[model samples]
Target: MTSGLLKKNLVCRIILICTFLYLIPPQTIAAELHLALADSTCAPMKEAGLAFTRETGIDLQYSCKSSGLLARGIQAGIIQADFFLSANANWMNSVVDNGLIDRQQVRPLLSNDLIIVTRADSAIKIQKLADLTLPEVTSIIIGEPSRAPFGRYAKQALQKSGLWDELKPKIISKKKISLAVADLAKAEEGTAAILYRTGLADFMRLQFTIPASASEPIEYYAAPLKTMANHKEKAMFLAFIAGDHFNKIFSAVGFSVIHSINRAPEKSVKASH
Candidate 1:
């Protein structure tokens, strides 16, 4: 009876061990890849990251910031993302110049447009970009040209329309396009703003979207970092973005997927004298 009872106890222990082994994962899952993208593409990118993980079991960790700041961070060695997507060419070039990214891997992926917007209850009226120059408009919010791609585009639009000098005094510069949009809602009466059209859906009083010809197209480029430890995973992520599936995600969020990135060599869009 004692030997039989001991045999039964050993069998129970073997069964428990088998169950625990079955519950354990077959292989350790990989850590998430870091992706740095422009703030404007945050929503769609997040969604895309989820879908990519579902499809490939490789997760993504996102860090969204203004393209300029991201470029500076890359230069300063403060940011270590496997991938970096910028809102404009200049910032991407800055990364390349700093020897942080390989130019061969860089490719344009999406484009966005600048738009003039105002509060729904704003008393100040605007028919065109020139309208901001009127004395009645107290303040105009814009991304600061030095560090914001949208602001640089907005400045170019104003300069293209011969409105920059006249409107510069009234311009209230914000560090990021998101901030400018948010502040526009709470701005005092008689104030207006310019920001990315992608983020203008919920906002009222969208005066007009600046034509691409008016301001240089806001091009988005993506590339993997040469220093990234997860080179294979980064390549997979870039490949995922290159496919039509990812383009659908971008289109849903107001970004136009562009097959061809041809444009005149980037020259500084100078403010009118």
Candidate 2:
């Protein structure tokens, strides 16, 4: 009789364990939603992400890639991002072409400009964008124009100055602005580079800046992915992005806030995907 009671208690405990396991959801644990962003703006994203989590308690998982790579990832269905932050409208359009993002959810967020930079100790002095062609400047680094927005802007500025042909051979294409900056640091003597204003904050020895009027206005855009599993969480983050708090974050990172939360200005120069 004692043995029978022992077996019955064991069966009851097994049934209780199975019931507990069945009642709990596999995905109920804390998890971070995915965000795909431009590699150059990672610093500000991290700052904003921390603040966002503090207020919303939802962790953000960032995948910082070049705008081209991010777009391709979105297109190929390799990256299942909740939010996509691109440095240029062209790359964003590429993703949109793939129907990965909802059109109504897209909006321009901020703007930045290209600037000239040399190593801190370099003797090259550039007083203007045209000065990049000086004899002393042998190697010039710009991001790859095909994938990097900053690269395309730099190319446009150089083309406008009629120096694209003369400087094309000297331009070394780096995938990331930060990589280009690092290349500048380790470059042979007489090396220089063209980078975005956002990249200038972390580096020294700014030679000259391309006037905003001279270069095409570099506008960054953001959108929520249609495949997002957590729309409520993404909407919260998108609201934060359009709020004044994100404006400060962008300003701190040297970006000019567009202020319009729903659309980019009609006058802004549009880039082709």
Candidate 3:
């Protein structure tokens, strides 16, 4: 009789354990979601990701780099990301063309302005684009056009303004815009760079704004990969970013939230399986 009672108690404990496991949410057991984003979006997304983790109990991992590099990595299957946020439409279109992400699901997230900046204490005074050609200016740092959208925009603006040829001698191309900004910060007095107006370090001061007519519009697009397994959790994250709370976070960092007529509904974006 004692042996039978002991066996019965063991069976009941096993049943209770299975029931508990079944009741737990899938996200609680699944791996953390991974995101690939352009370096420029890191500032706001970092804060947003934390808030998402706190609310959903789903942690996030990030791989931030130049949009071109990130897109290439995705195409080559070298970077495994559940979602991607690109700095421009060109890179996003490339991923779409490769069938990595559904084009219909891509949505514009933010917009930024291009501007020229120099260290605050720099002796060189640049009031306009033409000022870059002055003898006092030694090197003008810019993102490498092939890898960074900001660099391509800077090149296009210079070409349109007819300053490309004249300024070519002093141009220093960095692989990423953030790197170019860093180079400017540490360089000698005459160094300057073309960068997104948002997130400039305190020591950096705007020299002049690049007019919209000078280059293609700067816009950011985001989409989840077609291969992602965590659809429900991914949808929750997407909706979180589209909400007013995330918008305020982005705005605080100087990003202009996009509200296009064709934008996906703010409540959710259904991922294509």
Candidate 4:
């Protein structure tokens, strides 16, 4: 064959190869699964993700934020995740109602306790919810009720205790629980914060455990996104999440594992959007 004809044939082959590569679906080439988790679950879920990767050789990418914000992101189609681990059922229900997640696949995974904490070195002595109203208690920090489940739980506890009216004036709201914890750590002597009992640092002293009766039960739910329903890696990750190893990871961080058989019927929340 002529050299010129050979060169033309090679160019045509290269173009066809490039076109075929461009037409391949993204999922066919991507081996990583994405998880959207609440910030409070960061430690355990991260550990779990790493463990899953080690066991199955499937990579994972995760985003952590308040459950409300994550849910909103999913509803707005701004976030794409194979799975979502929510801090509360309300936000999970919102996504389910919006068709972002499959309702039948929603699994109750963990539970947490709400507690009042102050810096270990603080002089303020708070024995109960009522002490929050004392003159010496200068400021109270909590997550933003609109974007964080911990914040909503904190608000409910205060309202049920009849302390909301008095404490509202001193309340300082943060977009996430981690920020609230950070603010409390740097706050003055009288500052206190309501936070999840899980993942509390040694510098924070727990003053009170809010009674379960004071607010709705704090439950964490894991739901697979509808778009990833058929993903093989997602199935592996879900199995890992339900296994004893994952349970121990969360329990070590003070989270109570909720077994499938023990899951109670979760209350539904009206979809906000």
lDDT of each: 0.80, 0.82, 0.86, 0.85
Find the 10 residues in a row with the least total lDDT in model 4. 264-273
Better of 1 and 3 by TM-score: 3
Order of quality (lDDT):
3, 4, 2, 1
Report clashes for each candidate as comma-separated counts: 0, 0, 0, 0
lDDT of 3 by residue, 55-171 (tens): 888889999899999999999999999999988888988898899998778888888988999999988888889999999999999888999988989999999989999999999
lDDT of 2 at 133: 76
lDDT for model 4: 0.85
The per-residue C-alpha lDDT of model 1 at residue 64 equals: 85
Q: Estimated TM-score per prediction?
A: 0.82, 0.88, 0.87, 0.88
Better structure of 3 and 4 per lDDT: 3
Local error of candidate 4 at residue 139 (angstroms): 0.4
Predicted candidate 1 versus true structure: per-residue lDDT over 177-197, tens digit per residue: 778878887888788888887
Clashing pairs in 2: none
Encode model 2's per-residue lDDT on 1-273: one tens digit a residue: 999999999999999999998998755556577889998878888998899988887899988888998899878878778888899878887787778876666788878878888878888899997788789999899989998888988888888889999988888998878788778777877988888888874446888888877666688888888888886787688788878888898898789988776564343323444
Output the TM-score of candidate 4: 0.88
Candidate 4 residue-wise lDDT, 1-273, digit = tens? 699999999999999999999999865674888789999998788888788877887788888899998999988988888889888888998998888886777877888999999999988888999999999999899989888989999999999988898899999998887888778878999899999999477899989888888887888888889888557777777778778999898899899998872343344422222
